[model samples]
Target chain A: MNGCMERIYNGLIKENPTFVLMLGMCPTLAVTTSATNGVGMGLSTTVVLVLSNMLISMLRKVIPDSVRMPAFIVVVASFVTIVQFLLQGFVPSLYASLGIYIPLIVVNCIILGRAESYASKNPVLLSIFDGIGMGLGFTVGLTAIGLVREIIGSGKVFGFQLLPLADVAAGKSGYVPVTIFILAPGAFLVLAGLTALQNKVKNNAAKKGKKVREASGCGEGCASCGGCSGKVFPTGNEEE
Target chain B: MVLSENKFMMSSSPHIRSKTTSANIMQIVTAALLPAAAFGVYNFGLPALIMLISTTASAVLTELIYQKLMHKKVTINDFSAVVTGLLLGLNMPSSAPWWMGALGSVFGILVVKQLFGGLGQNIMNPALGARCFLLISFTGQMTTFIYDGVSGPTPLAVLKSGGTVDTMSMLIGKIPGTIGETSVFAIMLGAVILILTGVIDLRIPGTYLATFAVFVGIFGHFQNPDIGFFDPQYITAHLCGGGIMLGAWFMATDYVTSPITKRGQIVYGMLLGILTGLFRLFGGSAEGVSYAIIISNLLVPLIERVTLPKPFGKGGEK
Candidate 1:
């Protein structure tokens, strides 16, 4: 149980896909112009991720390692198509706003990364939880970036006006949106800022003698060992 | 001379040291910029002054507070922030609210300067970086040039739109543009001071202006039918009517962002000229000097790599 919980915690904070792993940057930067678009893209990716992780884990024994990458792509792409149609039918607005990104989720490194690293090796129940955790982490990162960009760029939150617009023609003083925040450069600026903020938090936690792992290219899990290779699971099962 | 027990001078290279420091050089730059900044105030009135003061104050304050929070030694006394703030202020439209300048200054100092490891480590000129930031963020506010209580299109804008402007008025500082950019005469005066102080030479600005002039003479008439090929009036107006003079003389010659090698400086200058001319002639905006300078600043590393001088007697012998 503790191991299961650790996987969730690791995904949410210690190894967040967007903020920490720095994966799926294409969708993270492109569709995150607003909070709604961010939520839409993130959740769509989450659904695809969860389903793909479960199926890949179930078929892990039959699938040979040589063709595993192609098999993973096929599983992820099938689930992504279903989510695409479901979104198109039920939530047309979100589907239209999310546009090409929904289809592009097949290529999102986070989903595939978890499938190859954790899902293939871990138990069925644990793989589902890993999918959920990583999905939620990506959702949180996207929503935060989208919320900030929306507020500063458009003076809106979730499509609702948060900051009053300045009417220069009427000589009224109020908020002036920094329109560049909605542009492509704003994505980079906000991502760098939020990533830096989290690094500071992680560093502070480390300074207090907390067992915060050092951040390598990916995160604690990937950096500590090669996908937790030759490690004993908390469930009392040891992988050779 | 006998050295005292505790006063031993152990240093490398030549023992002779000049009185010049970063602070001293920055002070000279500040002094050189005073004429243009002063003309901006006179031309634009109280609002320009307020904008200038707010920017300078905010830049210095941001540096001070950032250093304090990060527990680094305070270097605000060196006046680099002051020069950056003032340069950014001069780049701002006079009609822009004072807070915009303040915000730009904070962005320049905190993000562009201090965040990037402060003064010499910044990849781009801080003032130009901040100016571009503000210009993009607040397009309406940054481009509106108001003079004599009426907003008018800048001469460059007029030229961009197939209309002509008075060259003499532009030269005499009666034109509508950004605070310090309207006055060619005032900017030249500052440039002369910068030159005479031995702080800057003509290598970068000279090649930059020369290339830009040649580019304009060749391609400028394509956008406007009225402009003749190799027209002297068109060339002078191109030179005098925008931020090109201010940018070439001050911003492009930034020590940290520009290439150090003499040959590299020439390549950087020519790149600036071509980019500026390309942007002004074909780009969506009327003026492109700020963009040109910042883009060239980004290319300095590549230029330096290409133009690096061979070591003495190494290449020939090997």
Candidate 2:
């Protein structure tokens, strides 16, 4: 039970897929124009991730070592197709807004990465917990970025107007939107800012003598390397 | 034990030293910019003056605070921030709110300049980069120029829409444009000071203007079919109007962003010319000087690599 909770905590904070691992940048940058789109895309990807992880973990013993990649893709694609039809039938607006990105979730590195590194070796229950944690982490990241972009870019949050817009024609002066925050460059800016903020928090925690994992190069869960972050425990001497 | 200072400090070549410092060069450039800034204030009213002051103050304070917090050496005394703020101020519409100028200056100093490594290490002209940032972010505010207490389209905008402009008025600076760019004579006055002080040479600006003129003359007629090919009036209007004059003389010649190699400077200038021409004539905007110079600034590393002069008597590739 403790180990299961640790896996959840690990994915949500220590090795967050969006902020730390930097996986699935395509969907992370795109389809995050608004908070609603972000939440919808995130939850859809979560469903696919959780289901794929469970199936892959169950069939790990039977799958051939040489053809595991193809087998993983087939399983993931099947789950993705189910999620796609459900979304299309119920949430048509979100489906249209997250166009092309829903299908592209098959290639999202976070889902496949978790399947390859965690699920392929872990027990089915542990793998499901890992999927939930990682999925929630990605959802939180996307939601944060989307909230910021929507607020600054259009002065709204989740389709509700938070800032009073200055309508010059109506002579009611208020906040003016910096539209660049919603544009393509805004994604890079916001991502950099959030990443820097996360690093600052980690550094500050490390300074207070807390146990913080440091990434050497790998995404903190490399099955091939036997966990790279465990080897080089940073002494807090090297500052970026 | 008292450590005695060594008489000889070992360093790389270009051993010949000069008294000139980065601060000295920056101060000179700041002085040169005064004429155009003065002209801008005269052309507009108290708002233009306020804009300049606010921007300069914002840029300097941002730099000071950033350096202080980071425990780095404070370089505000060098006057580069002053120059950057002034340049950004000059590029802004006088009608723009003062906070916009302040925001631009903050962005220029903190994000574009300091974040990349202060002074010499920045990837783009900080002023131009911030100006482009503001331009894209607030298109309506940036482009709304006021002349003679009335808001109207600039000479470039008029010419872009196939209307003739008074070249004499544009040359003499009685036109609606950005704070400093309206006055060709003022920019030339500043350019002369730059040349006299040896702060800049004609290589980059000269090539840039000549190529731009040639490009406009050749291709501009196609855009405005009413104007015949190689029309001098059309070409002159382009050269005189908008930010081209200020950009060619000042921003494109930035030491940090422009190419260092002699031959590379020429290529950079030609690239600037073609890009400005393309953006102005073919793109969605009426002016492209700021965008052109910045894009060229990004390519400076490549230009320097290709145009690197062979070291003395190094044999050809074996």
Top of the candidates by DockQ: 1
Task: Point out where model 2 deviates above 4 Å.
Answer: A212-240, B1-14, B315-318
Which segments of model 1 are wrong by more than 4 Å? Answer: A210-240, B1-10, B14-16
Clashes of each: 0, 0
Docking class of 2: medium
Q: lDDT tens digits, residues A114-178, model 1?
A: 88888887767667768888898899999999999999999999999999999988989789999
Docking class of 1: medium
Best by TM-score: 1
Evaluate all candidate structures by whole-model CA lDDT and list the values in order.
Answer: 0.89, 0.89
How high is each candidate's interface RMSD, in Å?
A: 0.5, 0.6
Candidate 1 per-residue C-alpha lDDT over B150-174 given as tens digits, one digit per residue, 9 for 90 to 100: 9999998888898878999998888
Q: In model 2, what is chain B's TM-score?
A: 0.96
Candidate 2 at A136: error in angstroms?
1.0
Query: Could you tell me the TM-score of candidate 2?
Result: 0.92
